[model samples]
Target: MCAYQEAGGTDMKTKNQSPRPALPRTPMTVERGVALIEALVALLIMAFGMVALAGIQSTMRRGSDQALQRGEALRLAQGEMETLRDYSVLSAEAAASGPAGTRAYAGVVSAAASSAGGNTDFSVTRSVADWADPVVGQEQQQAGLREVRVRVQWQDRAGNEQFVMLDSFIARADPALGASLGLPASTSATRRPAERSVSIPVAAKDLGNGTSVFVPSPTATVAWVFNNMTGVITGRCTVAMGTLNSSLTAADVAGCSNNTVGYLLSGVVKFSSAARPDPAQPGGTAWPLDVGIVNSTLNGAISAPVHQCFDDAPTSAANTMAFVSFNCFVEPNNGTPRIWSGRLELSGLNLGGGADAKKVCRYSADYDGNGSVSNSEHPENYNAVSGSLSRQNFLVINATASCPAGAAINPENGVFVNNSTVQQQPR
Candidate 1:
């Protein structure tokens, strides 16, 4: 009281009389640290993305490897095909006549071989076994022809097996090759007709008929060059099919400038892989002959006019070369006519001729109750008959059912092909 009286402080403190109430206390702010959780979530998503990317990368790598392997296999197959084309000889004459390095066409299918292709160990194989599958490859097969396939096989890193194949054909008639190889110009005596700008041949018009018939002709086949290309790379020349001689003649659409003739008669026969012969059937009976040697010359000397027909067929039932219906026209050169007196023998292909050379088709024919085939018909048999009297099937003539006086063949005429078309390559 004394101090207030001395300074009159009461007047100076006149504001809100009571001491100013303390402002209400604000509660302390708090935060729930969510950044860490968000960061964790982002990391998890990133991890998943990384895993997916890793999977994609692995898949791409494997695919690349597979592509490379496939290409390599294809290349290997192509190389093998080229090698075969360069080294193979169609006949024994060609083999012997080849300049130096030539080998038999049969040798091309020797065996499967191993080679290195990139990082893979590849197996390479050549075969005409496709003929056993019937029409699967009939376009490239014929009496004087063989279809060769070059296959390459390898294993991938994923433990999967992979393969690629290249298909081609080899014909006994490659004039260009024959000429280049310097092979002799010999013709098979078997009679046939050729046509078009190119002409093939038939041995001889029978000099006589029936038992007195003699085979073969000379200068009938004109020089032709087989392209030696695959059906894939090239196509075949063909004439619309019809009756053998009556309606269709080689000269109708195509004919040899020379006496040349070519006849290709075909029909499908069921077959399997180059399979084994059936044990159920008697030996040699399980399959048809691998190579059939028919001497069109009956009375004439077995010379250049000899017919060398090499073939493979689909004989699934027999588990060997397939049985294809075969019919060709041949008669006495004298125009006489023949009967059943010429039921010839034939041979077989199996165990012996498959594993390697000398085994491709060891034959077995037992005609005349001989019980066995003479052995002299082996290697030496190609050029000429090494053994004259073996039990193999020979010319089975078509009988004289009806005789039109002035028929195309008159009494007995042969059937033949007229034209051929090619694909992928030029004539």
Candidate 2:
């Protein structure tokens, strides 16, 4: 019985040890699990690396695009700068021509922008900023140079922006040569002591609108007075008509016509120096004098044409009066402002005349052939004709005043020109 028990126990022990031996050899499932875990870890690492690489590529692309856009923008700005530099009078002309919209530059270019890089693009635009008042230039400043600024702005696809700017100075090229002629540079200024008013007479009736006539003045000689200190030039005392007639003979008229008459006359008077008026004579005087006649052909025929003038009416407002027919220089200041300078010669034949009836009258530079016939005619002698004048032999009037420095003279310098057909007449 003892031996049987021992055998049973051994058998039980053997049975228990039989499976234990194989189990310890390898953990197959655990190994598989660990392998799976490693595989998963490697996949995760690879995925992360790929994601990082993609991000780097995206950043690189954005950077490159941005660089390209910036380079293009710089190029565009340079091109625009070059374009603005070519215009000499950019400001004065900008109102007529200006830039407003996107324009292609150097071709093959596109630009845009957005929250994301490289979403927006670049385009060009322009505008002007004025730096001065136009009217004040004439009224107060006398000489006004307007400044115009041009700005160009651009944008890129990456939502980046850039801009360029340019400026120009513009003024009247042929402004009044008054300062050179002893005239004040502007109307607001004072007249110098040496300045004297000249009396230029004319017969408004005899000479038709387009007729170029030479009429002699009572004063044969006159002096152009200039003020070096003040830059003012004025017309001085004129010689009497009786003295002027002493040099000519009736036979001189025969060459022009059967009833030979003086129609127009114009000559220049020069002085050695600008001098003050003769205190004794109560008239203006200047230094050495040089007188010479000028013969100039008219650009257009002198004929009666529509003339318009504005005068203060009963309403106390400036309004246009009756239209007169006369020759005129057309200059538009914003609109039509009819202003002219010349002589009005009358004919003895046009106006019935007798002895002691002087037909000729002198005229100053201030003459506007506008408004009523009287407004454009010589106000002092509205009914008198200078003489029975021959249209063939007209005197060319040297009406222009020269600058002491050899510059041209005009009212723009500050002196008030009569610019009227009439003058200080017996009102």
Candidate 3:
């Protein structure tokens, strides 16, 4: 049979073919497919790891940049605070005073580059406000106390808003030491002149008898100016008496009877010294003019003492005038009585001269003699004046009467002095 097979014989089923050499073993095709799958999976895992690492790196870089920006912001904020503090100190020293109520150094400063690339811009703003010491008495409210605030703003790299703020309290320097050291020569040389002025309405209350009381009008205005170089202070004030309740009619006023019926106030105020000094010396460092009053009907005037005058020297300009007191009495004998008393508070002291000079004054008056002041008795007033001097000049006045209540000026008329009104004018 083998010979037949080798010879290609036709014995169909009996011939044994050489077993076909086992079909070449097929080369383990399943194993080859599995190896390829494993290789693909390993590649996929490596790619995923690389991607995750990149994400982490990006996050770390962002975090680092944010930290840097935050640090820079803080630094800039501190720098701005220092700059403001320096300016305030220098200004206070130069002026020899603390800031008034609330004064802004200026508008927002120009934007500054905070980063080396100039991509980040920052702005600084500063404001100064009067700070009263709670521990101290009201008498020391304006002494050695101020609040300063500085704010810095900018945008971060991510286009997010960012800001930093610094707050501090500034105290007035010792007067003796400050004056001895003085300000820098350059600053002193650059000092500008100041103008002062005020306007106030006049009010009066009837105290009966032939006497009446006078005070600042319910609506009053005041202003002041200071000259750093000459150390002179110029001030002006205005009072309105149109609404005064007086017994004098248009005829009496026209006849000039108001002059004798009304009283005038005159007193000298010295800056850099105590109010109402024992001896009342002249030629002081700063001199305030005597407050004088005149009635439209009268040609003569009377003198009076100033009530509640404040001298803010230790913590402010050596010659600064803080507040003024004015009180007076008048007797027209027209069967009317009048009384008036009031005070003016001067704030926001500035160096330059302008309408702003009168912008920071507050006037208060007592109209009913209740010993309490009300908003109704206080009115906004304005004044305009121009002058340049180195000293502070202002007026403080008060008045009193010598007549008893219910006393009749004329017994025959049976129309004794009853309703009294005090009139005021600006000078």
**Candidate 1 structure quality by residue, lDDT tens digits, 33-137:** 577889999999999999999999999988998999999888888888777666454555667876787766545564688888677799888776424435342
Tell me the lDDT of candidate 1: 0.38
Sorted by lDDT (best first), the order is 1, 3, 2
Q: Per-candidate TM vs. native?
A: 0.39, 0.28, 0.32
lDDT of 3 at 352: 35
RMSD of each: 21.6, 21.7, 21.9
Q: Which prediction has the highest lDDT against the true structure?
A: 1
**Candidate 3 C-alpha lDDT tens digits along 202-239:** 22222232222232333332211112222122122222
Against the true structure, candidate 3 reaches a TM-score of 0.32
> How much RMSD separates candidate 1 from the native structure?
21.6
lDDT of 2 by residue, 1-427 (tens): 4434454557644655755444447656755678788899999999999999999998898777667666665565555545543332213333235464322211111222222224444555433233355543322122333344444444644455655455554343322332355633544312222222111122211122211121233332422222222212211233334333334333322233222111122222111111321111212112121122211123442323222111111222132321111211111112222222223332221113343222111233222211223322333222222212111111111122121122112354544433211121111
Each prediction's whole-model lDDT (CA):
0.38, 0.30, 0.36
Which candidate, 2 or 3, has the higher TM-score?
A: 3
TM-score-based ranking, best first?
Answer: 1, 3, 2
